[model samples]
Target: MTLLAESPVAVGPPAAPPADRMTRRHKLILTLLLGTQFMLTVDFSILNVALPALGADLGFAKENLQWVATAFALPAAGFTLLFGRFGDLLGRRRLFLTGMTLLAAASLLGGLAQSQEVIIAARVLQGLATAMATPAALSLLTTSFPEGPLRSRALGLNGALLSGGFTAGALFGGVLTDVLTWRWAFLLNLPIALLVLVLAPAVIRESRTPDKVRLDVPGAVTVTAGLLALTYGFTAAGTYGWGDPSALVPLLASAVLLTAFYLIERRAAAPLAPVRILNRPSVKWGNLGGFLAFGMETAVIFMMTLYLQDVLHYSALATGLAFAVPGVAAVVAGLGASRIIGRFGSQATLVGGLVVQAAANVGLLFLGTDRHWFIVVLAVLGIGFYGNVTAIVGFNVTATSGLPDEEQGLATGLTTLTQQIGFTLGIPLLSSIVAAGAAGYGSTTAPALALLGGIRLGVAVDIAVTVLGLVLIAVFLRRAARKNAV
Candidate 1:
């Protein structure tokens, strides 16, 4: 449970980048890493605003349009752990470069795609590229900066840029779709990926786990398939009913595959995810906190978007602009996160962040059809964003804090995996709740009123879940402290 304390186990000496001073080279390295983090995060939301335009131009069926987004999400969530292990086994820098190269190719293909099939293929490639890049980039960041204030600062910026990227993607996607074309949304990544490809090799040094362990092929295959099925199941449930075969079949398959993965890992000589690492309280509870933080945040935002567009009758561009203020708040939170963590510690900061987030959700219950409520919505979202960013940084710092140098990749992989899963599943889960709530309204109910009722119900559930997670995490940390004392 020593979530904040350094691990006693040191497989190898930690990387000694000038911990005392920040040099120009260090600045370059930090920029490269943070930039990559921002780009990857943006990919999650960039296509969302453009989906309509992209679908129309490419002849995508209305029912199948979700696949454009899901295609990218499935492989990204599914293969992240495997690629993360590959970073440890092969080379982090090597995997990063390969991912960037793939991203560039995928972006080009997507931008020029003339058909639905081609675009989906491009999206799948983009997903694969993200799977390879995200963990490698994160592990590189952790290794480059020795753990302490420096590492906390780097992670804070990483958290900030991540929130900023998601916000920007929505805003930029709207602008591009309106002014230029949906193709610009895909084309934008080409330059960013190329820049990273050119500069990363020069600035970042290659590092990997020192142990020459064999890859656990069975463990990798099972876990990858399990996660893919899990994500697909949730997505289908969101679109269709939970009891539908599309959702039920995948959910059942995920259960079986994940169980097999667990058993295989137990028996494997070199497990893909070591049981020892998974056993750590920080890794276990920290990731759970991460999952809730991301899942709830995403769900809240999705509902808010629906409220804006459906009830408030705002344009896509206007809705994007509305969220921009919160994005700025998140950036501010990220910039100040290190100071907050330094003063209060990761545990306290995380708890405080969750409290603020819960309070913000409570404020969102005041949302109504009145336009003046937009002011309240904006204010609460800003507060929520600030809390979410700090909590996210706290989760990252706590989860990866005590791990050995050799497992940094694995640790970062787990951190990012929870985030992707949270993002992928959050919307569907909350959307289903909202749908059910809306369906309960009588035929005499107004459409706006029914939608508003559904949104309120969903927000109430989100608040409760956030509170529950906060309590559980607090109890877990408190017990760990008592155990350490004993």
Candidate 2:
């Protein structure tokens, strides 16, 4: 999508101060970019509802059905930085449009797939295109909005889009998959993306640094391979029995590539990810906190949706509607985060939000058949509100604000990668815990309850981690305060 920027730089020069920058019509541009994010988000989980349809239509074995999801997620997770950096050096608008074009081709091809392998290949290409587009969308956002109120507002909208996408996807998936055709679900993006590609030229301006620098091709490839290996290894455990050669090989390969990635980043003149930006106090802790938060959050949603359908015997629409509560609350909280942070300080707002969410997880831990689902859903929605929007996206804005223009893309990439990693890792991690817990019990209520227990255990771990992160924020603040006092 074309970002209608005056210059090619991610963040254009400080235009005539706050007064002039306030007039920036980023709202319209973002409306289109977020449409892209929504489609990707929908596609990821929309398949969960349509898995049976896909299996029947495409004749996918139990082992390969997941590839439809993994193929897309892995490529997107693996290449955020690879493509984000390309946008920085090359041109975000160009990279953005090219990604949409590629994804459009893949999506149309996917709609016409006659074999499982062909469909999987299309999904992989689609993921790559998403990787290129998603980060570019975010980086363009950073550039389009100036550093303070505007940027935070823009990012808040992004958070809303993200939270809303998950709920919408599930709801639409059932309708599109059942009523029309499963292929239409995949085909939905064709028109939306085409519209974005067309409108982007008029609404969004192009942005890139004027400096000519060689592309960091090696760094991109190595890191991409490394992340793919890691995610592939983790996500494969479900189908491969964790002991299968396919699983072990990818996991081991990921370990090796990850080790190599660090070494390559250390020496590269034009690194895909700059190690230095990671050195910032806020940037480091913020990223650590963000990763854990998104990872646990994604896993929880996945588990809960299944529990409602498989165990609690709720219909797909009811399950989807239940999730909409949280989506709405997240939208409300996102709009308020900037104001809250300004009033309460970033540490207070962020730590306070995490603490409350830990409490919510504690509440969710006790949920079972005897309990009221409405109450449980309400608590979960409330928990989601402050926990998500105020934490990851807000922290990112604060952390990345300190970096240089060149490093902005890298900063966005690192944070985006962390979220993607969390999403990728969360699936298998939570699944293994639940599946293992179920296996320990017989084919009865005991096993089903055990799955709930596994979710509880997972949430407990997340609460502990969230608490630890909050404590770290506390320590980080006190130390900075003391240093300043001296």
Candidate 3:
């Protein structure tokens, strides 16, 4: 019955030929990993549209309502590096399974929560779970697939699903809130998480660094503290004004803690993050590109959502439908990115994608008052979404393409950290710009028209930021490309 026993080849010297490429089983594993990432990203944006309903139901004060999002963002951003290192020290598969279990529990708690505090706490748990799971998933993905083109293609598809999650969340958030309740947003994760848990153990083989290693507690503490401080400061600056000590103090402390982290890493017996890895141009510049790509894109989505609802008077369902086309386009972009990058090269592909995003933001400048504009806006915005998705794939591939097996988790963690910080910062920074525009518009225009003006101003700022990001990609990625070619 056994093929080996039936064959002429002996068990010792001559052996059966092994498969060199990814098989169906490998593909299934990739699907499971990508699906986990998709679920996490969807949760990130789903809350935006449901905030009002949630606040009213939970009787949350206006200021406290932000905690629902902040709770998730802070720990997710802070603990990612720590968990990523843990994945390398412990078994990545074990950490991944644990994270999913915790995430499922947190989702259930949040879904059933009656008070804002309880939901916020659940979100904090969700953040911690995400922090553990994402880097491990990414690490496993890199190790499972062969490096170079195979890994690049896998990263491309991963990028696509991740981008699709955000777009889908924006669309579905409204639909769910309208049809059912805000709680469904949290509850939806339960089935998906459970499925990943059941399938992961069977499909994913365990991996770790062959050499024994210990966790670097000092590095972990300082880095986590620094990131937390930085995230909190940026988020608070958006809400409470940048001049407030509440914002300024954390920023100052972040500088100190971050510097201490670097010093600790330099002196540690086995460093948490190796300095040589950080020194890589691809890792540094790639993350900057990722930060810009995510930050501007999320800000655009937020502003557009407000414009559609407040100015155009669209229903929640209509808004979701309006975003449907662009969301699909984003997914397509992700799926096709590998082929595009292969033809064009990662550096060229990155620049081209940023250009597309900038041009789309320019298109938003001409937004009209009537419903007829929705078709034009969505189409143009879809083009931008396409560009962002491509850029995301490029950045991911660029960042991890050069790393050794052991540092894969570190590379992936840093990438996700930039993305989370981008999401956290974009809302406040762009919102401040919109607020400034509103103040400048004064009483000359009607309230709706004034809001429109502010939104336009915000889009213009986004255009400028997109251009700046393009410059960064041009300068840094090009250098990295040349270095890698040598």
Question: Which structure among the candidates has the greatest lDDT?
Answer: 1
Give candidate 3 misplaced runs (Cα > 4 Å): 1-21, 403-409, 439-447, 479-486
| lDDT tens readout by residue for model 3, 1-486 | 000001111111222234435667667978899999888888878887777788999998866676688888888888888887776667678889999999999999999999877998999999899888877777677666665677777888888887778778888888998999989989999999999989888887776565667778998899999989987887776567677898899999999999999999888887777666678877887777788778888788878877888788787767766777768878899888888888987767767877887887787888878988788778877998999889888888777676665556557667766776676667667876775676567787777777788889989988898898779768876776678789
Local distance difference test values of all predictions, in order: 0.81, 0.70, 0.78
TM-score of 1: 0.92
Tens digit per residue, CA lDDT, model 2, 325-420: 766767777788777777876656656666666667767666777536656856675576557767755566655666655555566667677756
Report the C-alpha lDDT of model 1 over 139-229, residue by residue, as the tens digit. 7777667778888888899888887777777777777777789898889999899989888877887776655668789988999999899
TM-score of 3: 0.90
**Residue 385 Cα positional deviation in candidate 2, in Å, after optimal superposition:** 3.8
By lDDT, the better pick of 1 and 2 is 1
If the candidates were sorted by their lDDT against the true structure, best first, what order would they fall in?
Answer: 1, 3, 2
Error of 3 at 380 (Å): 2.8
| Candidate 1 residue-wise lDDT at 353 | 86
